[model samples]
Target: MTTKENNYTSLEVGTFESLLSRNYKGIEGKFFIGNELGLSGCEVSLNRLPAGKAVPFVHAHKKNEELYIITGGNGTFFVDGVEFNVQEGSLVRVAPAGARAYKAGDKDLYFICIQAQAGSLTQATHEDGIILNTKASWMNGKK
Candidate 1:
């Protein structure tokens, strides 16, 4: 189910298998969903690279740092000429100027990449959240 309300947007991207089946032209297994959600602060991409494939080139951010959450399979991440072996549980942070690239391993690799301005967060959820007196209607067990 997908919801588009005044305060937020919800997208049902389906299962991991659905995500991997998409091929844009000749490129397979990559989806950029940030614009679909009208994102303003960051860009998010869901990627599933086939075994042995790598991102075509290395890249670096001018102001944004990337956080890659590895959700499945294996890969080697290159940063500044250094290599780091990554897998299902790996979480990687690449600083704004760190040159980076990735290559998938023997099995398909799945990851979510989130990019936002480096050092730009002034407050986290705990610090920015407001305790509302109103109760959530969903709490009535009707999601």
Candidate 2:
């Protein structure tokens, strides 16, 4: 059986790259959607970073699992206290509550980042910083 295609096309990430002057500028991330035909359960995005640039801060997620699939350029990813060299064709996954950070190497870097939502709200703080969300009303407002 053949079914008619949807009236709208799936989001294309790479196509939007040209619309911006700097691939990674002004925002926390630079991204475009590729094909979200079968996307489910998790959030996916295409991220690009210029040479010598860092994405976000050095923090970890308390209840979110994330994976980075390197599509181009070199990316250095710090996972769980170790630094892993990421490049084209590299797939890195950071489990929930694990430490993770990434930076572009000497060249521009592009990759697809997949983040699976946690069952409940997640709180994350830097490795050396104080607990940003220590107080929780659900937990009797304890830190």
In order, what lDDT does every prediction score?
Answer: 0.89, 0.68
Best by lDDT: 1
In model 1, the runs with Cα more than 4 Å from the true position are: 23-26, 137-143
Q: Which candidate wins on TM-score?
A: 1
Pairs in steric clash, model 2: 12-33, 13-32, 13-33, 13-34
TM-score for predicted model 1 compared with the true structure: 0.87
> lDDT value for candidate 2?
0.68
**48-141: candidate 1 lDDT, tens digit per residue:** 9888999888999899999999999999999999998999999999999999999999988999999999998999999999997787887766
Superposition error at 58 for model 2 (Å): 1.5
lDDT of 2 by residue, 57-102 (tens): 6777766788888888897998778987989999887888787888
Score every model by TM-score.
0.87, 0.61
Question: How far out, in Å, is residue 122 in model 2?
Answer: 22
Candidate 1 backbone clash number: 0
The residue pairs that clash in candidate 1, if any, are: none
